[model samples]
Target: MFNTYRLIGAAAALALSTTTLAAVSPQDAAKLGSSLTPFGAEKAGNAAGTIPAWTGGITQPPAAYKTAGQQHPDPFADDKPLFTITKANLAQYQANLTPGQIALFKSYPDTYQMPIYPSRRSGSAPQWVYDNTLKNASSAQLLDGGNGFADAYGGIPFPIPQSGVEALWNHIARYRGSYIVRRASEVAVQRNGAFSLVTSQQEALFKFYDPKGSYADLNNVMFYYLSFAKSPARLAGGAVLVHETLDQVKEPRQAWAYSAGQRRVRRAPNLAYDTPISAADGLRTADDTDMINGSPDRYDWKLLGKKEIYIPYNNYKVSAPGVKYDDLLKVGHLNPALTRNELHRVWVVEGTLKSTARHIYSKRTLFLDEDSWQAAVVDQYDGRGELWRVSLAYLKNFYELPTTWSALDVFHDLQARRYHVQNLDSEESSTVDFSQAIPDDGYFKPAALRRRGTR
Candidate 1:
């Protein structure tokens, strides 16, 4: 275990000295798709063999899947847990767990547990994405002291990341198809397990991943998003539009909110940073939407290297068709029986709040899955440096698009003994539709919000 840590640390140190904020050398870039996975993950498995080597992740949908809009069936439904981790035996597995994972075991000694399944590196992107990632290895670079990146689009930027900021940028730019539409619900489960659903119709067009677009065409815009609230009288008819800029320092995120009550559209600058997500009932912040989003300027990032940890992965059962939300959302956490945990190598990045910068989370430690470039787990600290919240992204491959994305994101507030969940659409008419045609930018503007809002 120490050897693995040392090797990863040494590699990171070398990259820092050689690459800095610039693209890696041709020799190092050649390592990608050879010794390293196309996305820059180690191609070889660990010595223990618990984690297998990556062999071109899920290239096609499972036999169980019938069509594009149907709920994704579990590809590994026959697999069973090798063992389970609980508070009683937590010490034995403590080394493989994060601070937040350990805290959860302590928070719910009897109820909270992790069912360990065999590691399956089922993360893949389209051939075009892989091609772009290889090209980005020697061209993509950070801009303005790591506030943003340049000369990279349509693939993982900084695949051979030398710094924490670069690794975070990879997650922000990870492919999720060009356009998608879904009707999902968010809920803040109270201490007693009761919750109210705040549902929305969400649409996003990933300008960074547009096939016909180029880095110059992006003009600093990462993506365009529009969300219209639909549910329980109060939130119904409200809408939000966001133009997520790639270089937030160059041009801050442009956002607009439309009120059904006031029947007016207004600029919403507070939608970024630590502003409370009203739909989350104060349990989550705007930055916590996709585990962590928005600018990383408020924090000083440090690359802590890599570690083999048990994280939530390939969790299809949690969002399986016909699975009611009540059956999945328990008191302290999601139903452990439905979730799957696997041991996998992950890059650890620590973000410490800059002394001059202000945010609710004083510190954050992110565990990014090597195969997917997704932050699988995040431990957030409060002003006093206490473990305040734990965030988990239950990931699964959308084989149709062949991209890995979170099925559901859960944020656990240890002090409040409550949790908030996003992207729960099991009962909806359809799952995420990646085949949706990309809409024009006009559809995501402030004027469109008022036109789309339906009270």
Candidate 2:
């Protein structure tokens, strides 16, 4: 493992070049399925063989998962943890731990722990996505200033990314299915571990991945989203609509909110960066929704190169239908016993706030999964340059869809000693329904919000 780490470290230096706006050369693009995984991950394992080579990920659901939106069973349920990292012995594994994770140990030494399981590369996508990814390798080019890209539609825009911003765009454009509807809740856990549930029903139409659609047909729109609050007396009957754009700089995200009291749909331009997410009780920002989103214009992004780190993966237990929120949400962090961690390669990228721009975070370090382009762990620093919060995506393979997505996104406020969690559907009747039929574009418009709102 030590030798392999050294080898990757040396290669990383060579990979971090100055030119980031151009697409990869034809010769480099040819390495896709041969030397690299279909989605741009290194196909071979490290020298120690602890991390296995990429076989075609889990393309089919296990026999246990009988339905599309039902609880997914763990494919590696029989595997056991190799070791556990705790405050007492954290120093031994400090090299593999992120600064945010180390801070968690200092904040809650007794309770915070990570059970490291054997690595599994279980990230997969449909064949069409793979085909498009190969084509994008040589054609996709970053928009002049890096706010977005051009000539990329169905798959990851930059499978062989040349810059930090390019890699970040991969996460933004990664496949999450064409249309999806999920009934979930978000909770802000207080310092003492108390919380209230803010449940909502959310739907999204990923236009970028529409099989019948093309890049020109997108019309600068990436996806259409609509969310309706479903629970708790005070926050119920409200709705939010968003038209997420491919080039946020060309045109910022179009958003509108329907207030239950006023019965009006008003433009919500404040839904962008640094705006506090109401559902999170000011613990997280709107751009922090999917770990990181929105325009990259405010920050100067840099590819910090790749590293082998222990991250939350294959964490099916944490969101199992049988597990109640009361049992999962604990003081300091989620119940460590229910979460699973594994060693995997990730592209580390740092986003430093541009000197001329302003935002809550001074800097952020993101660890993106190599196979799925999912940001698994993110460390956010405050204006004082102190680590303020840690965001973790507990990833699990929805083998029915054959894509790896987060089961729950936990944003931990280190200073406040509170944490906000999104996508808590264990108590709901079903999980994310990717089987939803595509809705008409009119369904996500501002006028639709008014019709859907009921006070």
The candidate that wins on TM-score is 1
lDDT of 2 by residue, 116-232 (tens): 999998899989999999999988987747887899989999987666788889999999999999999999999999999999999999999998999999999999988999888
| lDDT scores of the candidates, listed in order | 0.90, 0.89
Estimate candidate 2's alpha-carbon lDDT, on a 0 to 1 scale: 0.89
Minimum summed lDDT over a 10-residue window in model 1 is located at 11-20
Q: In angstroms, give how far residue 342 of model 2 lies from its true place.
A: 0.2
Candidate 1, 321-409: lDDT as tens digits: 89999999999999999999999999888898989999999999999999989999999999999999999999999999999999999
What lDDT does model 1 reach?
A: 0.90
Q: In model 1, where do residues sit more than 4 Å from their true spots?
A: 1-20
